[model samples]
Each structure stands twice: as structure tokens, then as C-alpha cells.
Target: MEWNAPGEWTPAAAAEPGQPRKGILLIHGLGDSPWTFVDIAAELSKRGYLVRTILLPGHGTRPEDVMYVTADDWRQVVRQQADAMRRDVDTLYLGGFSTGANLALEYAYDHADVAGLVLFSPGFKSLSLDWLAPALAVT
Candidate 1:
């Protein structure tokens, strides 16, 4: 399945012919797009797993879009994708990078029965204004 969105990167699903589809959801990091997982997805596809990558609402596109998206919105997208994959695959795996990894963890926490999870460079903290309150107010 191909998902079109506003960005330089788009969601893609790749699977080998004749192989039973196995779902692997790849979530890109903050400000990043699904393009980050092209190589990873290709490698997994060669191994016969059905791999899918998604562009988070505010990522892989105009910066303005990011302003309009919230963490919950991203979560909704992941849920929708996982639901779609579950319909066809016997096993489902979730993976992500940075903030995307954080989202993946939240999803896994909610769906512990998932087949597996892969997180790359998970974001524990953000160096943005959202994180500055404590830093500046500490003094």
C-alpha cells in the first residue's frame, strides 16, 4: 500500500512475490520522512517480510504541517496502519526512529501482544522550547 501525504517522503509497503505477508511498520523520526527507511525496508523485503514505512503528520513535508500535528495524531496514524496490516499478516512488528520510536513504544505498551518491536535512536528528551521550562526555571 502507498500512502500519499505532504512531504518529500511517502509511506510505502514492499513485499516479495508469493510470500505470505508479514507486517513490519517503520516510523520515521521527528522532522524526518519515510525515506529514512528505504534501505531498511528493501533489505527486509528481500528477506520476504512485508515492510511498511509511514510519514508522520508533520514530518517529511512543510514545516508548517508539523505545527498542526500533535502526538495523538501520530498515534492515530500508527493505529490505523497497524489495523490494516493485521488484517492480512499473521505477525506484526513495529519499528521507529527518534520521536517516532517514542510513538512506537507507546503503541507497543498498548499492544503487548504484537510480534516484536524495533526502535532506532529513540528520543528520550527534546531540546526544544517544550523542554526548556524546567531548564530555565530551575535557577
Candidate 2:
């Protein structure tokens, strides 16, 4: 659906006369689109937050588009979006799901000004060796 495309919501300044403006940039998972955060963004806006969701490189189009997409590409987009979001609000935060969660964590790690992170099932740790954990532990 067209509504699934990237989205941004900025609450009216009148919503909180003297409250500090807060913003959050959300990222979608490897095979997901900005749609993932649509509902969440709306809810955050109702609470006076400036919310944004962006399509990672190679996303919001054909699946094959991601075939050659690199982690660097994703990092670049997240960095840009976060930077822009920072400019729009007084406090900045990041959030994501799955692969997106990993990217958010990476960016926040180096950007201390980021207020916090809202991660959903971050995919950073490798589970490939988990299946062998039992056997190795027994040794």
C-alpha cells in the first residue's frame, strides 16, 4: 500500500507549550519497509514526539534490490536520517526491528547525543553456534 512508504510525523508545537521537542528515527528489518513503524510512529506523535521511518537502501522496491546492498549502504541511510531527525527535535532516539535493530544500535553506539534506543529483537549476535553449545559444554 502507498501508506507503507516512508513516513514522518511532527507534533504541533502547541501540543506541549514548554515541553522539549523529542524525535525518534525508526528503521525496518532486512526484508521490511517503513510500514513496520507506521502505527508506532502515529502513537508517538500523539504523545508529542516527532517520529520518522525510512526505507533502508534496496528496500521499498523489488526484493532483488537487496541482493547487492551492503551494510555500509544501510549505515549511510541511518546516519543521514538520524542526523536530519536530530536537527528537527531537541532530543533524539533510534529504534528498529531485527536487522534494523542492529543498525540502530550501531549508530547509537558512536553517537552519545542519542538519548536512547528502542530495539525489537536485535539480530547482532550469531545463533549459528548455539546448536553446538550443548555438545561443547558437555566436553
After superposing candidate 1, which stretches have Cα over 4 Å from the reference? 1-20, 125-139
Number of the predicted model whose TM-score against the real structure is largest: 2
RMSD of each: 5.7, 6.4
Model 2 vs truth, CA RMSD = 6.4
Model 2 TM: 0.85
Output the lDDT of residue 134, model 1. 53
After best superposition, candidate 2 residue 62: deviation in angstroms? 1.1
Residue-level lDDT for 29 in candidate 2 = 95
The sequence of per-residue lDDT tens digits that candidate 1 reaches over residues 18-114 is: 5555678888888877877877877776666777787778765566677777889999999998887777677888889888799888998899767
Best by lDDT: 2
Over 27-53, each residue of candidate 2 has an lDDT whose tens digit, in order, gives: 999889898888899898888889999
